[model samples]
Target: MTVILVTGGNRGIGLAIVQAVGTRVADATVLVGCRSTANAEEPIKELKKLGVPAKLKALEITITDDASIRAAVKVVEENHGKLDVLINNAAAVTLPKSTDLTDVRESWARTLDCVATSQVLVTKAFLPLLRKAEWGRVVMNSSARGSIGRNIALELPPSPHWLYNCSKAALNLATIDFRNAEVRDIPDERDHITFWTVSPGHCKTGFNNFRGVKDPAEGAEVIARLLESKRGEISSATFWEFEEGKFQQVPW
Candidate 1:
């Protein structure tokens, strides 16, 4: 059975991804990572109702906490020998509601910690398990705001949210660099690991005060597809967008 771990899988788009995988991939094991196991209780119950063969495991993974991350790694090691797929979907935007310029500095620091820096740490901690698997896939749940071309095309300000947009932009570059580095380190194992950065589109989630163009399930379609056992022949190390019921390649 394939072992998949999705960070921030407790609610919203993340929960939708977990549900989709659990319902679709009958033989897969879904480990739902949340800040606390309590947050996963309801989701786990909901997943149980699906009556699929996929097993559920709730792991505590506070994105900005090293101890929490290490504990999650330990749980995965003890339960599953290896992890086949990792979806980095945990992110935070702690900026003030007033949209004040004065709070940008502090907000930027906190945003980068959760949105970008912590993802690198989580991936590093899980690399050993990922390598042990037959084929490992790392998916970065990114945003369209990360795209410079899209921003320019839409005529949005250069720094749309100051922290959130820039952090995602940094994540996009990191995704490319990380993929390239993996290839360089394992030229013979090219088929072993696949990396992708995907935009979930405008989803009506808590991130945007529940105002968006798509539902959480709709936003999670591409991500769930990527995690499925019978996946399509997708190009490795590419960016994707969930649009109009299909996953399309998005230019960085």
Candidate 2:
């Protein structure tokens, strides 16, 4: 069974990712990571209704907390021994429309903690389990907004998305940095781990108050596709965006 863990799996694209994996990969064990397992009750039932062969396990993980992060790592280590895939999908989106610099600063700090810093902590805690697997895979659910070139190409006027966009950009760089470090200090085994940053498109989810253009299921396709990819078929540290029904390389 493929032991896979997806953070923020309680709703939106994260929940969709759980279903997608259940649909596509048989015998997959999915650890549905959430901040609160009690809040995940309904979603867990829904995923079970999908009848995917994967086993859904609830993992309590508050990404912003160190103790929570370590506890999550312990659960997986004790039960699964190793993790085949790790999807850093938990991100808090705070829409700061305020023109005041103080408000912007506050929102920026909060969003960055959840979206960027927490990712580093979570990945650090789980790297041991990831390394135990013969071939591990790490994915960061990034955004096209993270790319300045894309923003210019789309002719979008700069707004209050500075904090959110910068956070994602930091995540993209983290993906690249982690991959390069792993490759440089690669183990003797040929089954090396890989990393990827994927933009799930502007999905109609809570992140945008359900005002986005794409559907959540559609947003989940790229992550599901990447999970199903064969080893060596993907380029580590490459940033991708699912555009025009296909995965396109995005400029950093």
Top candidate (TM-score): 2
lDDT scores in order = 0.84, 0.85
Residue-by-residue lDDT tens digits, candidate 1, 79-117: 898999999999989886555766666788889988999
Q: Which candidate ranks first by lDDT, i.e. highest? A: 2
Please give the distance, in angstroms, between residue 102's alpha carbon in candidate 1 and its true position after superposition: 6.3
The digit string of per-residue lDDT tens for model 2 on 104-183 reads 77788889998888998888889989989978889999888787677778755465677888899888889888987887
TM-score of each: 0.92, 0.93
10 residues in a row with least lDDT, candidate 2:
152-161
- Which ranges in model 2 have alpha carbons more than 4 Å from their true place? 95-100, 152-158, 187-191
Error of 1 at 108 (Å): 0.3
Any residue pairs clashing in model 1, and if so which?
none
